[model samples]
Target: MFNVYITKAGKYLPNEAVSNDEMEGILGMINDTASKARRIVLRNNGITSRYYAIKDGIITHNNAQLTHLAIEQLYDSRFTKNDVELLSCGTSSPDNLFPSHAAMVHGLMDNRSLELNSSSGVCCAGMNALKYGFLSVKSGNTSNAVCTGSERSSTWMLADKFNNEVINLKNLEEQPIIAFKKDFLRWMLSDGAGALLLENEPAGDISLKIEWMESFSYAHELEACMYAGGDKMDDGNIKPWQDYQAEEWLKQSVFAVKQDVKLLEKYVLKLGAKSTKIALDKHGVSDSDIDYLLPHVSSNFFATRLYDALLEEGIDLPNDKWFMNLSTVGNVGSASIYLMVEEIMASRKLKKGQKLLLIVPESGRFTYSIAYLTVC
Candidate 1:
């Protein structure tokens, strides 16, 4: 089999860590609904703090810039930008529709010679990008590739539609109770970027070696589970594309993630358990053989439930083997898996030959991907 390995990893966490208590202030003091909503989200989501990459009330970095900085953090003077043969980028939040985020990163690097690729929509965008780079190397299409999952979630999370500001508590009881599903993530979603460098074979050193990867999509049935687009007018039509105004749209066009709690309760855990089995069986890996579990669930609500579901599926993983950063990082969208993987590598606790199972489920386009990695 062709060899593909991740040689290095890096990340760019935002400058500010907004705690739950602090977020209550941003939600305004209009009524108790905001306070009650905050408690429900944090309690259910398990996010004590999350970050925002904002500078003077503006987005400090785009998907390309965030990923670019992350890749730079893994910089090796010996292996310059010229050594990179290809770039594969994935993101749900891109600066512009055309040019692709990968191409934009190339432009930001001021190095346009390398071939570039990108995948968009959903949190799984980043993992999908990794798959492209992995296959490229495995198929002998390219040797040195940079796979990145980057998101400037703060841009959309704080968009005008959901971020309502109230001055004083004059009419505290007048405001309606918030539809938690519609606005839950305006505060829950954090911002950051993460990256990994891959090669056909081990270079100077290796972080993780690829064993097998499997991804499937249920987008046909799960469309609009999480999405971003222009708002429709009351006249039962969308504003003409040419008439679309950026300033107005930026304020009202929120990236919404509204899911029926029952639907998630019914299928979320099953997807995680089933995907784990599918990937492991395809590669002939026994459930008892796993040394670690890196789950990319959006919240602790799902993480806890998925843990039990895997047990029912006969994969009894110990608690210590489970790795998650949702409490501190929140849901960083497409960059969640990359950020998790980068942090694990930085810990340097893994010994050679340890098998790590990375479970990825993206609701954007509803792609479920599982990656098997071994320490080298």
Candidate 2:
């Protein structure tokens, strides 16, 4: 198989940065009351500023538009839109359910028709798209491909979306706030897009040589931990959005993102470390092989916990060797790892032969995606 290299990386972080004090204003306050969980969530996530595609409840860029903008920035003298043979896009918060996210993104580009692949998942969706592009080029099916991971999370975080749920809870004489499962995510997610251009040859003075990409799913052993478009039943089964009546949709807030925090606390880090150890062992990669570690963490609350988990697995990488951008960019779901890569590449801090390990944990179903890339 031919080797695939990341020729360039680009990102688009919607409008100006929105500060912590401004988030509720933009997303609006549910029931005209401040979110009891917002400050606590933000404090733990450690995100001071984040961008949004919406301003004053108006969307400036849909998910497709954000993805398209990031892709447009990938073109240069060595690569143009016409040179793209494949377009793969991934997102959990897509604009529509009918047209695939990749299709919608491809529609925005003024280029010839090309093969499209859209990956559907939470955080790992981005890596899945990257893996698809990497393999497409490695297999010689395409000489070049563009892959993107993006999220327009603000669209779903709007307070109005939860109004019905709050009202329903009030009528039931329960605490008026939405469940912590759904309300906490409002302060954790951000809107942004990041893209990678892959080709048979490396571009510029430095490029990332895709060594190997591996993914693990513990779904067989674990129940869903994070989800949307469905309601979690008491039996731990997910009742899909389509299964509910239209009125029940708004009443239950079935479409709003939610997480089983207890499940996340129990399995997220443990499964991630387990999967990472397995990947490293399968490839004969040791802790010393990793020059830099890029991990996509949903909240900084898990940062030190993640380090400890990795140590338990015998991967002894230090804190300094780790690279993260969550504080500045917030958690962009599938785009988080891509954004981390984009900034690191732009920093020009990597040296030849240096190895970077990217770990993305998806609480959606205890999935983990680990990839190794070498600077060349």
Candidate 3:
């Protein structure tokens, strides 16, 4: 069996930072009620801060641009563009609805010696891409692979429509100005990018090796969360809307998580590793076994739900460790898990020989992917 190791990982956020109070100021001018609602919404979601791209930025800093930057940063000076045997990009936004983002990244990197693949199955794209890349390496078809996810929620956000319809539904006549301010923009959304470089280690530095990857899709729960193109108004501006049934979305997400945990248990058994044995395995050795978890940042509520479930299964975790970054990052779609990995590594908290568990829960036709990694 080929052992696929993560060589490097990196993430980039836009230069500007948006805070909650600023968002309220922007909303206050448009509709005081909407501003109040926005505060409640953000508070409920547990998102205090996020990043956005500047208007004059070279790259749009959307999903594709973020992914590109991440890959470039991770592989800096270590490998030439041609050393990459495959490139995979996962995102909800397509470059134009025709050409895939993978092709765009490949062209940007001047990578001419690899097959390119793209994934767009909503939030699960990143995990799916990683699994696909791992399979390619395990099958001996590729030696080096790059998987990336970039998201710019700001560009896709229709501030006027979002604020008007969702927040100030009762008194639209009171606030008429389309006030677009930093505060409102901050609460509206943020952008970020993350990438991982994987390779088949013949005998060199191996950061983390993938032990197993599993995915389960629950198709019966489609439409639990959705996005629809909006009708053009007389003013000629296009709008978009979210179709979310919060209660049902939560149900499916929980189900998916349950299934994912079961599969993870089975994989651990296959590897001769049990939940109880994780702690006693090793100390500081390069391959000493430790449980390092990286789960998808779905929502504050869902994160807690998963935590409870893990606790029920006797999976002990340090307080505030598993879902630490979700409150700040929000739901980053496919980029959440990878970005969590980046955050954990940056903190210098993970020791060698630790086991990292990555769980990704995607909405709408809910799908869950679980990956096991051993820190090297």
Candidate 4:
């Protein structure tokens, strides 16, 4: 049987750092409104700063360039163009609807001659894209593949739009709940990119053996939490999700203005833990077999809730054994798990012969992906 192993992990975060103060200032927050919101973000997410592709109040790097930089770092001298037989990428935001992010990255790498796959949707697209690449290797279609996930989340956020409207906790009773609810996540979202070079046979000194990978999407029955849909046209009429007659979505702008926080808090961790248990049981992976846990909890508050839920399920993972950089990176959409893997592997925290479970739960599309990795 063929096996796929992650040979190299790499990540790229914008050099431009955005602090909580900077975020509040950008949103045009005034008086104590910014402080109150900042406190909530800090208390809930434990994020103080995150990098962005913005410069002088303008977005500089698009999704494609970010992914390219990450992949470039993955190449390092160990792997070359010939070693990469397939390229797969995924993102919620893209540079262009055509050519696909993978094709654009292929063009950037000057590897137009090779095969590429680009998928677009919500945050779960990243996990799906990697799964596609994993299948590509397990099926013997390719010996090596480069999988990438990148996002310029700042561009898709609408914090600046609701800056003046957000009320402070001091005036909690004075404003509508939607105002604070809508503003909660936008400020915490940041930007980054992550890439991984995988092969059937290990090429580098370290490798993460692919033991099990599966994704479960439960959004069909759940209401959309955060999304990018049709914005208003010149006449102020909202376009449909996709417009076939016009050949364009007419989405002059797509942003998240509202989210169901109650819905998210209600089912996110419970469903995520259930999915984790399912994968663990299916693969016969025991709690004792796991040496590390990499969980991409979108918010810091969810982190505690998820920990409690996992404990109830009888999987007690210590805090030190869990690796997360959300405090510095925020929620990077599809790029979250990739960044986790890159940081973990590069930090030397992963020794040979350790089993790690990567838990990725995306509220944007109500999906859960649990990947069991054996480090060697």
- Colliding pairs, model 4: none
lDDT of every predicted structure (CA atoms): 0.74, 0.93, 0.60, 0.76
State in Å the error of residue 9, model 4.
1.0
For residues 63-175, could you state the per-residue lDDT of candidate 1 as single tens digits?
77888998887668766677888899998888898888998898877655987889886777888899899999898888878989888766554434343322111235344
lDDT of 2 by residue, 107-177 (tens): 89989989999999999999999999999999999999899999999979999999998888888998777
Itemize residue pairs with steric clashes in candidate 3: 22-183, 23-183, 23-184, 63-150, 288-353, 290-355
Residue 100 of model 3, lDDT score: 86
**Against the true structure, candidate 4 has what lDDT?**
0.76
Flag regions of model 4 displaced more than 4 Å.
27-36, 158-178, 230-254
TM-score head-to-head 2 vs 4, winner: 2
Model 1 stretches with alpha carbons more than 4 Å out: 24-35, 163-178, 204-206, 221-223, 230-257
TM-score of each: 0.86, 0.98, 0.72, 0.86
The best candidate by TM-score is 2
**What residue runs in model 3 are displaced by over 4 Å at the alpha carbon?**
24-33, 55-60, 160-189, 202-206, 221-223, 230-290, 313-323
RMSD of 3: 9.4
